[model samples]
Target: MDNWEEVHEKWTSFQNLDPSLKKELDHLAGDKKKLEDAFYKELTFGTGGLRGVLGPGINRMNIYTVRKAVNGLAQYLKENTVNVYDRGVAISYDSRYMSQEFALETAKVLGAYGIRSYVFDELHPTPALSFAVRNLGTAAGVMITASHNPPEYNGFKVYNEDGGQITPAEASEIITFIQQTENELTVPYLERSELDNKELLNWIGEEIDNAYLEELAQISRLDDDGIKREKDLPIVFTPLHGTALELVTKGLRQLNFTNVDVVKEQAAPDPEFSTVDSPNPEEHQAFTMAIEEGKKSNADVLIGTDPDADRLGVAAKDDAGKYRVLTGNQLGSLLLDYILSHSDKAILTNGRLIKTIVTSELGRKIAAKYGVETIDTLTGFKFIGEKIRQFDATGETFVFGYEESYGYLISSFARDKDAVQAAILACEMAYYWNKQGKTLHDALHDLFEKHGFYLEGMSSLTLKGKEGSEKIAAIMESIRKEPLAEIAGLKVLEVEDYLSGERTFPENGSVEKIKLPNENVVKYKLDNDCWVCLRPSGTEPKIKCYFGVCSSSNQESVETLESLKTEMENVMNQV
Candidate 1:
């Protein structure tokens, strides 16, 4: 036993832990830098799995690292499927703090390997556990959320069976069977009433929330005289206290949507969200109680979701009625111009629009003004749910997807970003811009009077532990050895660099190949239809950056997005 005497014999084998994790392993026993930051490594299930800060060592989130990451997803589904216990493992959880005892210790560590386990008896949203892992034909899926982190964080994620998240070569072969389960205190688990009496632990609630609110009412593009003229569109929502309060208020009262209000102190199920300081619905101070109940119910949209509702935040109200907030690239360019002015040009000639190369090229110029085609992943809505499962046999049709960090997806049912289908398409795009008398802030100022003033901005930077992971890998290796041919002065004419999968161009030294999936991200473009990226936030410690601009007005795209955010914080303060 070497490694610090095997972390003090695994912190004295927690002696039957859970007395508040044995008083946090006796307050980090002799505090060798807080027990080498909770046991120097071990919680690394990277490509979206196992988040931290819950407690008792080996880098937190306990129940023995959630049963060694559900026994490395039940030994990567008993060595890659063939009915590994009948292709099961759904599970879900979100109110945080030990999310239902780490989802029944991840269904008793996938019922001690004979697998099968549905779980979710309550607290749902993380896109209803990605539509309950493609409605339980599951070979994967687990989501004890850290979705919108805080309340001392918690996470686990993993998903696949095409319900997205869990790829990066199945999280590098399930972190090589969760680092060969050396000992999460001698692993093996089972006994959620003996895995629910060998039905292998079932449960599931409201038959998966009424088939995930009937696929969130086919993400409403509204009809029936536009839901009877936006059936009293007041809207206000708030689930900021976690788990989209009973399916975004019963999926907007099952679409009849009568002036909905909610936010009664963040509507309940709150795992210490205690009225926001960071339940992150992409921060507008987490919509301070849904913009003070949207200025006392005059409301015209004020949504807020976070804490596992799968990120969504809005605000709306403009035309001097006040409110504000938009940006997640202006509600993904007003929900892709209200789903391309109510779709059907034969489905906009086989539409598409997935985003995230740090989103907001004004949603790839409003999906090139309806002629659709706009892909660009690597930031994770599970790479736009693995590009809608690689264009699901290529007939093309996924009309909406977003991520400027307010995360959205209209309807591919659920492959992640779905604040209950973006709160019913953001209250049917704010009642189709208040029945044209306008306001989603006047359809984002008429899409910046037809796409020119496309401004966007983001910045992050936080540096936390291990010299902030060696200064976020020395600021992405000093921006790949200094490559900014002009940022605030605007003229970098291309650079891509998704960790050198290549793009270059820089005034003629041509290069191209970035056909995705390499990720460490960086981009540039500039010179008019301006741009800028620079990744690192694959689930925060921060580096972000983002910014974009188009100009030809809106105060020269907000002064060239504040001079490319003050030259990206002076290039992250000179790395």
Candidate 2:
């Protein structure tokens, strides 16, 4: 629909809706831009799942849209199940705007279909929700969080029985069902009170928290004795004002980390995330307060988690007496090395590591040294979680798993990324390293020397609104139509077009099938141990490009990265 027609339709529909929804619609009716933005299109739901600004509109995340999503999921479950309620669903939410309300709404919708739901009484981290699905033996799970997105945004992530995000094939089926529903308001739903009365909505809170914490505690490689000896090892932590506050602080106390400190300004959940422009831990702004606090406390390490506490970011004091934040790749490599180096040789003998192909290959090199097999999957923690499940079923040990975007999982107990668990492990790593009179920076440099120097960076081009989105699609099309045989001064050895499900070698004119499920991503491997990948953001209107380079020296690695980045920029500009 054209912009004006779409706006008019939404305005007319707003006048005809129920009183509550009509009130919300009226609030935006007078503003032409607001109306246009709200009615541009229905919110897109792909493999990364649903995300949008929370408001009342077809393009916004609101009660009607959420119910429509749940209705689709309900129908999918009913049609595919022999006993609908037997395969129940677990529901959890973070501290985002309307997150709790959305969680209850989801349960109510499930209850309307007579599908039982176990809903957390209060906000919980995303990883806990993933764990609950498997621990409670539910068929699926839903987490109401936007991860590190801005406060205006909210999202819904669907997970399968194995506690991983829904696979592409399953997500496509659900999306079909969602689109088939014409009137979102017509989707059935029960009131939260009514669902509770029917015993279809079960409130699960502290009991589950205790159980989850117990399992997390068991995964600790450090004992009370070790923690006691290193209790004074200074550590700083920040939750970025989302669900990890209580769990992470309590977990640290339980581990006997006496010198641990939480950033006071961001310790409480604030829906606005008032202190920072963006709550994403990967961005330096999110850690501004935490780093300042660390400097004052003279903390040896600084750690932060996003709003939902799924992804983790770390910073540490280098030998130069300056604080430096480590990329997800660097942190993952450190954790992988520490875990393997500290683990029993017997466990290491049968262990395996998993990471996304977009993640830095440094972890694989470390795993290789430990004799641990490394497996690569497509980007997304769900793929890593799926591999963990597969390994568990096949009796293969899962040593570690991570993605370069600050997501990591060490134990199978929590099926998704657990910043709480990561906080504990990071503190423990600091404690042991401190006892050895070394810092994380020193350890990182040592690893870099042992393995080849690996440097990686990411650039995202956000194309907001209708015009921007069309431009993004055009750029991807251009790249596909005119494939590059060389980037910078390096010859392209292979081009993996995930969307086409084929890998091509330009020099030899050879092509091979790609076994992974199809996705709209293209990766290029260069002869100089450098690689680049391009893929559009699933939940946002942005195109992301990833660059990875390896060299014998840090200077060479940085120079190569700079050259490739220039070339990639030129390609982007041309489009």
Q: Which prediction has the highest lDDT against the true structure? A: 2
lDDT of 1 by residue, 331-407 (tens): 87788888888888888787888887767777777777778888887787787888888888887888888888888
Clashing pairs in 1: none
Which ten-residue region of model 1 has the weakest summed lDDT? 1-10
| Tens digits of per-residue lDDT for model 2, 1-575 | 45655645754665346566577776776897777777778888868578998887778888878989998888887776556696689999988998998899899899998999999988889888888987888878999998888888999899887888888878888898888887776778888778878889887879888888888887678766764553877788988889998888788877777888889899899999999998988897788888899889998999999989998998988988778888999999999999999899898888999999899989999999999999888888878887887886788899899999899998888888888888789878877788888988889889999998999998888888888788888878988999998898899999999999999999999999998878889999997789999988887778999999999999999999988888887898679
Off by over 4 Å in 2: 1-11, 14-21, 30-34, 227-230
Total residue pair clashes for candidate 2: 0
Please give me the total number of clashing residue pairs in predicted model 1: 0
Q: Rate the local accuracy (lDDT) of all candidates.
A: 0.81, 0.86
Residue 335, model 2: lDDT of 94
**Per-candidate count of clashing residue pairs (backbone under 3 Å):** 0, 0
